[model samples]
Target: MAAVTSKVSLKLMIDTESRRVVYAEAGKDFVDFLFYIVALPVGTFIPLLNQEMVGSLGNIYDSFANLSTTYLRPNVNKDSLLSPKAYYCGATGLPLHVPNVESSRKVYRCCRNVTLDRNETCSCGATMNQESKYTVLPSANNPYSSEGDFVKGKVIYMVMDDLAVKPLSTVSIIALLNKFNVKEIGDLEEKVVDLGRDEVVKLLKASLLTKTILTDVFLSVLKEEVNCQQEVEGNF
Candidate 1:
């Protein structure tokens, strides 16, 4: 018995068994000793505060998100994308085709780059050469009812946003700085840090994001530049 007691005492010191036992007993005496010691009111207050916050926030009623899951809400009305009465005129680029033209038999008239050869000329001397006229008829393609003359040199506005990248609103400056580097970054790093800490984090807004889809890279760049200039002038 004496030998066993001595061996256990020795093992306690070696393995921190004595400390573990003391800690367990101490913890039971003072429930949550670690949290009380380290977190103080935070541990006790969290659940209470969370309950209070949730209770307060629960009072906020939203027409959209607040609809009871048990009570099914009626879906809002949806409008059709294309309006039937609306008509739009886009650019006239298609060629006026005159098929079955014979070189020898008939006198032909040239109109708006369209030649009325023998096949196009009616027996009544009516020239079949079509001078393409723009019209505003309800169609699947153009639904805006835009005027025919509105096709030339129009400017468009666009926006781009993402998280991993800089905010779009701030991008105007950031992009300028990153691209042109009018001012060095080392100087602005502190300002950026201050903004990160204190500001509302309104993102950089990139405008006039010209999409070069299906366009040659070089041509797109020039076209985009032109578009940008036109947009600026038009806006101003």
Candidate 2:
């Protein structure tokens, strides 16, 4: 069963120092903006943009001959073995956290035929196997097919440090957690430890889609970036 994001009341949040309109969400309109907000801070905006928006942005590769169509296509080649796989909540058919697991693996294995290393451990606290780490718990939003793409027997868990390491920025992660009704870092730490890495990732990422996070994040960004004084009526 997919988890549907809960609805939240409308409120404007402000970023006093930067004076930038960071969040501008209200009602269902705000829900559409969550992915955009996440992509901006992370600097992976191009991949997430829709074709209509991409078209308005102009040809990504106008100078390169015959490449306009190529850039306009979907972000990845679904059939390519090298294409990146996105994770999702097994219960909800939404894009979940895509952890940076490849970097955290202490030991990298090329194939199943490779000899095991006795002294290696993955970020998830398991002995490393195949060199790359991937999630197979059923993310409906994932472009790749789970059957052909993921290893059959590997134990998949959410990765904590990966996004933190992406240095997704302290504020963003906290904001995401807050939307999930997680109030403090200590609570999140315990939750991560209790739920294990994979579940935490799913929970946090999926939580972004929730009405609480969506509204909070939208208002938070607006408080930070949008010119609230002129655009909005009063103080947050």
Candidate 3:
């Protein structure tokens, strides 16, 4: 087994058989991680974490519109992506269609010819006459291409934990929490380190985590441990 550390706050113990982390340690300083985190949109950053590679930002040559829609959460009453106004397309100078809860089911005026079929591409062959009022965001040809790609200008807050190449370790994750200034009930640092692996899982489950670590990965490891124990008992 070899332990590897990076300039970033993450560290890992590599087991030659699986080439995966048997253990990990996260550092206290989050300035570097947070610097990169705020610089890109969540959609773009997710892909980078999964693929371990970056993609070029898509061309923002189209127009934007006030796409107001109901939020998916039942508790959220209403939300608006932009003002309830429409802008002309960059290429065609045509009025851009803003999507709303009602309009989502109806055919869009600008891309009317484009199919509603989810399987195929929706493109309108419009050639731009002049600069558009809207800011066009980049897009990818592959639907999943943006899994780990990074964009230069946009910023976002949340990210999926599983996308990380190696999820942060317990220590590292605690450091992250410390960085966030989560108020400790008592002896938080020492208590966390002293907990058994299973007890750690239970402790984490009981506590509310507003900012998550690699939840799926961490839970999976715990589940695997349970299964391994079962298998050993069966053999005996």
**Which candidate should be chosen as best, given TM-score against the real structure?**
3
Name model 3 segments beyond 4 Å from true: 1-26, 29-31, 41-43, 46-216
Off by over 4 Å in 1: 1-126, 129-134, 138-140, 143-145, 148-169, 184-236
lDDT of 3 by residue, 78-148 (tens): 21212121111132211111111011222232344432222222244342222223333436642111112
The candidate 2 region of ten consecutive residues with least summed lDDT is: 157-166
Model 2: per-residue lDDT, tens digit, 196-227?
23333333443433434323333344445556
Better of 1 and 2 by TM-score: 2
Of 1 and 3, the candidate ranking higher by lDDT: 3
Compared with the true structure, model 3 gives a TM-score of 0.22
Q: Each prediction's Cα lDDT score?
A: 0.24, 0.32, 0.29
State the lDDT of candidate 1 residue by residue for 138-189, as single tens digits. Answer: 4556423332221222221111111111212344545544543335333331
Greater-TM-score candidate between 2 and 3: 3
TM-score of each: 0.17, 0.20, 0.22
Q: After superposition, how far is residue 221 of candidate 3 from its true place, in Å?
A: 2.2
The global Cα lDDT (0 to 1) of model 1 is: 0.24
